[model samples]
Target: MYNTLLLLLIIPTLTSGQPGKCDQTPPQATVLTPSENKGIYTMTIDMKSKNQNIYRPDQTYVLIVTSNDVKRPFKWFMITVEDPEVDNSSYEFDHRSVDVGSLKTLDTNRQSRYSERCYNSVENTDNTDKYRVEIHWVSPKQSDKKQRVRLRAMVAENSEVWYVGENLTIELGKDTTKPLDSPPFPPVDSCNLCSEARYEVIFKGHWSRMSHPRNYPIKPDNNGYSHLVGASHSYKYILWQEGDKASPGLKKLAEQRDISVIEREIINAMSVHNGTRTLIRGKRRDHPYMFEPSHSLFRVDRIHHLFSLVIAMKPSPDWFLGVTRFELCTELGWLESHELPLYPWDAGTMDGISYESATSSTQPVDTVDRVAVGSFDKESPFYQMNLNDLKPFGHLQVRRLDVYPLVGDDCVEGINEHEGSQEQEAGSENVEEVIEEPLIQAIKQDPSLQEDNCALSEWSEWSKCAPDTGYCGMGTQLRSRYRNDRKVYFETYQDQEDFQDGYKSQANMAANCRQKQDGALIESQNCFVDCL
Candidate 1:
């Protein structure tokens, strides 16, 4: 009996450290395939194999595992790179890969799947070695039951690689993306166009005095027209697929008023945005001719952030004004307001006089110039003009239109009143139409009105101050005066011969002496008395 008890004690000690059958189960691994799209590589892991779900909870517990035990299940899956040189800094897994939702498969026919995506980090290297993705599944019940699946990734053509402190580059075979060879432009995607924000673009045209004096005398009757003509505007996102080169569509818009070519090309092309052209206003003779404002709406897209615009100057031979590859949407969101001054550019496709010459040089399209040397020479009527001297010939403005509230009652009332007045003016026949004659003709008829001498009129003596009222402090002292005549005249010769013959005539000049007189009337002393 004593020997039997001793044997039972020995048996308990021998079995205490031994593993159970559940601990002996081995984990199975399935091979996974890797695929790529637009340079991003992905591999999916299925949680089930054969007839059994690998992620299922085992009833026979060597250790208790619950749904809350995320670290235990997550520890089973592992990813490793075969090539040590392959950079994996930018590798990321889809949300499903880490979310508990991925473990719940609704359809028994299909298993739960999780995926990982790999791409080059913002930093790029010259390493050309092939990279591998290894998925390891480790059994929690048994250390010897580990299984793994391996996959090789294929590098896609034209993959984008971002470098630290540098702009992004496209990987084209063995060639790395390089900076543009032309003049330096603002950084790409400086504007966040990939967001869900909406933007509004407003175009305003402000006319200024002719830049060059010789370009004047734009005789409207010479071309059977009345005044100088403006331009029709077209805008579009810059196209990178066409090697970022100027397309025939862009050339057509620059030389002509048609935007159909550009619209069609951009619509047919892949990964690009097309913009519409704005209508042109009629010709005008007055300086600061304000064109009716034009506006457009756009949803920012990823591949197209930089926008360009072209406006063909009418009554000219292939001359235009434009801004190339300008960014409207930025990291700070859509620009509140942006102003662009317009300038003239030679399209180089045709050669003719600046005014409605209707002559074509019939030359192939060439690089745009401000003014070609011999064609629009210094003496030419279309000579290049300085934009600064003209202040703002044309301006562009962009604003966020979605956030503002609608007009209130007072605003609506005012708008209705203004519209009513406009309608009355449009319908009335009593309103006389004034036709303006040419300034040269008026000048010739009044040659005596050529020059003006800045002459000041005499000032009258100050008036007596009024009796002080018993106000809080002291009443304001007052005085007033007027000149005998405010108008003045200067002498000018009629012609070169008249000037040589010392012949001169007087012309009336409108002077601002009245303003000076008013300023002089006010005393330097304080006008108001202190309040009690």
Candidate 2:
């Protein structure tokens, strides 16, 4: 009665181009489960829909569903394996979004196992488990209302796995009101300190030839696992002894542990050869590591001994690749020594030979292959170390330690904090002159001194006088003035043979070479020479 001429208009829900399409159902899909193992595997799913009026065949759709974890605690979903179907027209294809609507409803468990952008390996590969899939309407629709649908399907093995539902009901039925309750998620394994420990498997085998022994790295099998190899050489006794040899009683342990055995010959050359030693000048009179407190400091009287271990690849060593390990023994037990601190240790590819000094202060364990040794000069703090300061078996122990002189005794005050002014004064007064006043003046004029003509040539008398840090060319700077006066020598060559045989004695000379009008040849001959 109140609206005799009233008129009403109703708007229908619209899709991309059509209206009143909210009642349409979406098609189902087929899903496959991961393989049996819990490492890394893949699964596939297929979607199908023929309701052109409700769901367009040309229009693309996304599918997502909840994960089934109660059946397999270790199982995880990998989105990378998804491959959607493309239509005949290159312009159109089916796509899926993982998190929305019914798919979100199914995954209400709230415990997501996937790390953002991080890949996880699936242990199982079989396609027998059920997975959720959702369809999203992405194109611009005529209606303001959004449309989405979801369904669950089991992936068939190998065959064309596809969606299984005739069509998903979009209405808010009793099924929509009651959510499917999923099982609680299991606790993930989280080992903090355990994760820090590096556990590796090594495989050592000939890569190219079988008859000859050689080592090479190979890809892991279907499983993602690799074996590290041990490098053996013939140069050093330690490596030679440990080559291809396992710990004395490790056979049983090897059987129990996850180990990879690479059958290849160690091709390092330094193991099969000997290293040479060299002489280096020290900053102080005594060798750095052996310098006495009362000794004078100068390069002429301090010759540091240095040893070297040169390693080279027989044919050529692969620097970018290859693996090696070290071992150590202690009162507690045997432990795998950490990899040598020499990062990027390589030969042949990097350089044919590698160098290690004896003064390196590195501790020695059971065996050292391709290892180098060296000594420090008097200028090194270790040069003056006493037995008490040198720990023998502790962590600070050095098996092949060496010293090198870096500064002169003139800077002693800067390096040593305990010098007393009173002692300095006393030393200045008591120190006797090694060279006679007349001899010093004569040597200064001639620039050389002969053992026979030396003013002070008696051992007792010379030693009792001020320290005579003899000449560097050919004399024991510390020798008693008369004892083998010319037994010492000097040279810059690093070869061991050059300094071993000893310098030619200058005791027989009649006059100082420096004083002679023409004694250049004699002075040249006095230099230390390499035997070879």
Candidate 3:
């Protein structure tokens, strides 16, 4: 049996001198799911040179699964291709191996699934005690125009530990429309013809003192924020770094709410430096209090995986808050959803002791810093509060909307069809060797190891309104626990927000956290209540 080289990641949009988006060489590039670690392995093509990056439609190519961290070995994995325009499973694997005595599963009704690696036997396993393997893929013929495809792979260390591999992407078919200047990262940038993915940026305000408006500080009557300004760039560039003096663009943006300042910077980076690819902008919200949750949508590609954004506080002394350089991709690919705590920062451009302080103090500090105490007077707000004691002024939530072909223009933002989703079944497999079950004893383990024991860390605090999504959404309360010691579990509580769709969004995603049924302690998490 040939070692199945099962990777087919060509790449996503890239900046000049940056690694391929799907290529694992640059690190932290792709993932099937969002997580802290970018994983140690990724898929790659065994091409002789960079020119072979394009798939010439109908040609058979050899795919390989390689790792960056060779010290970390794995046992099982799942791989597939996603090309919305084509059948995902139609891109078949070259299964010419001769072996059996494996688990039998029903495939697409009567069709059996292809060979899945396990300790089937010494000779039949795809690879054991190894760091890499090779698989084959037969590319489909081009139809009318070229379309992009994503090769997603999932690597697991047993059932409980797995890293989502960075996606391997490549364009299918020949681009005959115009002779391209060059392939991005090699020749030039991929034309911004279509957006590869969509993410919803939810800005949740948490500035209220003691959770009550009647508290000490009065809410500003003219409170609101300017449009959110951000960029999607490679690992090499940063929109604003903490500790360093803010860039001319960022300095102007934070203190003056001038988005054009950063817009020019992003355009220059894309054209001259080749470090950034997309310039992201959102609409301005002008309303009283500004504590209510608001959201905006932006598009992204694989190469430009790191995100940096900044927004201004309308009434403070050059106070602002936003992520510096947040990573958006996981080992498997881009995240489905993510959230972060947001604290206020002092842009160091002006001096003031209160929200209504000097508008033009005109004293610039050496570097940017967080909001800190300038006076010990009790009348001065947040002066006594340590940087840690000062609760987050707001929070940021990112939820993926859609990816490629299906996502390009403005219409794709609020039109996500998450309901009625289903998975496709598999087809028949061709195994040449078969051994009776009685001959090969199945490896057994402790029953406690397999039971779905309730294992978890402490429950996280209930999220503020606009819990999981945009608009007045429900408050989310989540806790990370291992289901059968593997999957992350969550429980979101109520806070009176989005009445129409919030309940629907929660129904299919989380384990309900509620009181136990009378005389039935086991039924605590199984109950459902109407949010109406």
Q: All predictions: root-mean-square deviation over Cα?
A: 31.0, 27.5, 31.5
lDDT agreement with native, every candidate: 0.31, 0.21, 0.46
Measured by TM-score, the strongest candidate is 3
Q: What is candidate 3's lDDT per residue for 200-226, written digit by digit as tens?
A: 566776665454232233545556676
Q: Estimate each model's TM-score.
A: 0.32, 0.19, 0.38
Please give the lDDT score for candidate 2. Answer: 0.21
Q: Which stretches of candidate 1 lie over 4 Å from their true place?
A: 1-185, 189-194, 207-213, 216-246, 270-290, 362-364, 372-379, 382-391, 402-532
Q: Output the lDDT of residue 36, model 3.
A: 33
| Count: clashes, candidate 2 | 74
- Specify the poorest-scoring 10-residue window by lDDT in model 3: 435-444
Q: Which stretches of candidate 3 lie over 4 Å from their true place?
A: 1-196, 209-219, 271-273, 359-364, 373-379, 404-532
How would you encode candidate 2's per-residue C-alpha lDDT over 237-306 as one tens digit per residue?
A: 1221213333321221122212111111121111102211111111111112211111111111111111
Winner by lDDT between candidate 3 and candidate 2:
3
How does residue 51 of candidate 1 score in lDDT? 30
Residue 298 lDDT, candidate 1, scale 0-100: 38
Model 1 poorest ten-residue lDDT run: 496-505
The true-versus-predicted C-alpha distance at residue 205 of model 2, in Å, is 22
Displacement of residue 527 (Cα, Å) in model 2 is: 19
